[model samples]
Target: MRTLEETLAWVAEGTALCRRAMAGLDETSLLPGWTRGHVVAHLAGNAEALGNLVRWARTGERTPMYGSPAERDTAIEAGARLPADRLATWFDESARALADAMAHLTADQWRSEVTTAQGRTVPAVEIPWLRAREVLVHAVDLGTGVRFADLPEPFLAELRADILARRGPANVPGVHGDPAEVTAYLAGRPHTGVTTTDGAVAEPLPPWL
Candidate 1:
């Protein structure tokens, strides 16, 4: 298992990379597919939510930053129009706060369970990793041309694991062929296979979000 410090570092680095990628964009670029802005906003909201989770883990409080899905969506929509600098600042601050909290956790604390609003229990140690994955993956979803290869290897590996574990073969669009092809598919890119040994091909991703 990875250390909490390692997970925190990865989250910090991924957030920084995402901020850099979103820097200096005009409204047109920022609003691509009507999703670029929403993607960034969603990430910002995720940072806040994960930070709250860290706080709750430390304090044994069940406090939640957003009360419902509607509230979370409102937060994201409001954050979408924030200036690039402000967005970056907010993300950086949230990441730092989360990292600081994680740094003080003991191994026992890391494994402690926290109940989410959905009533599912999760380990503290997994929170940062999940947040890192969210930041990195959604950065690509912003359609700023950021590729999966630009992400850190450890994150990509984690993403691979997540896709394999959470997504069924029939449900994963664009997946076909070998492991490399599957990786590419999950990254929202096209892949070609040379042999039949490669696995079943699937439909392309839907155009609508």
Candidate 2:
């Protein structure tokens, strides 16, 4: 399992990469697409949501940070309009708050369970790790050219395990073959020995979001 400090560092670095990537983009680059400004909003919203999870873990209450999807969407949309510097500031602050919260957790606290947005129960220990994945993966989704290979090896290993264990949506894309191919596929790049007969073709790494 990843320590809270490790997770926080991942979020910080990923957010920085996002800031750099967005610095190079104009309004056109921020428009809607597979990888777009909306994705950035989603990431920020996710951070807030996870922060709530940390609160619930600490307090044992069923408090919600976002009352509804519409509210979440509105926050993200508003964040999308922020200038790059302001957006980066927002990202940094939110992530730092989350990291600070997680850093205070005890071992028993980390094992506590809470209800996720999907209405499923998950351990608090897993929340920060999941959020770290969200931060990095969605940064890629926002057209940051960073690939899985660019991520820390331990993070990549953890992500590979987590994705394989989950049964929900394939958020990373392109996983129709061997493990190495799956890794390449999820990284948003095609593997040399892989072929897609159906489903979405694995777009190149750091896709033109």
Candidate 3:
């Protein structure tokens, strides 16, 4: 339930973080089995796919994020293989296009129902949250330096809530520590400082994302 303005600012900042992390880098990302090139390409592909949803909202045409799961995976792989300079341009252009699409949605259009790549139906207003989550989380996943602690506090809480809502409660032992600590655990990121309510170490959790 974030306001569009707030989400846009967060996306912009996260995009900047990602840009810095991927600059001149063709190395491994924090994500296993993904290079920085893979990460950047995925981001660029995601921007375009999500734009499809926005277009559906605006024009009442039914456009799914991708034609199929295989199509999506293939697209990411193809983009990842592009030359480094071309890959950067793809990300930059796609990001700009998505931002522009989000900015131009009318009030009624924002209320349009759109199905996510995950098959969940949500209002178009949720698009911002979806894109925000991508850039912000992937920025940290780039592992060039950004961490959960660097994210806005409110967004952390929102992310935590969203994860729990989908994953069904914080089944891990302990109440956990700060928002960043809990969010880090939920996101499957490396983190310390999380402990149970009674000072016991929090149990490791299965991947939620």
Instruction: Indicate which candidate wins on lDDT.
Output: 3
- Whole-model Cα lDDT per candidate? 0.65, 0.66, 0.86
Task: Rank by TM-score, highest first.
Answer: 3, 1, 2
What TM-score, to 2 decimals, does candidate 2 have?
0.74
Clash count, predicted structure 2: 0
Span of ten consecutive residues with least summed lDDT in model 3: 167-176
Residue-wise lDDT of candidate 1 within 68-161, one digit each (tens)?
9899878877777777777767767766776677778777777777755456678877888777777766665555666656777766676676
| TM-scores for all predictions | 0.78, 0.74, 0.94
What lDDT is reached at residue 150 by model 2? 67
Q: Which RMSD does model 3 reach against the true structure?
A: 1.5
Model 1 quality (TM-score): 0.78
Q: Write the per-residue lDDT of candidate 3 for residues 93-129, one digit (tens) a residue.
A: 9999999999899999999999998999999999988
**After superposition, candidate 2 runs with Cα above 4 Å error:** 1-9, 24-36, 168-181, 187-193, 196-209
Residue-level lDDT of model 2, residues 1-209, one tens digit each, is 77767876787777676666654433433223423555665676777788999988898888665788788878877877767667666677777788788889888888889877767788888787767777666655455465555667777776666654562355444346555455555444435445454655555544311
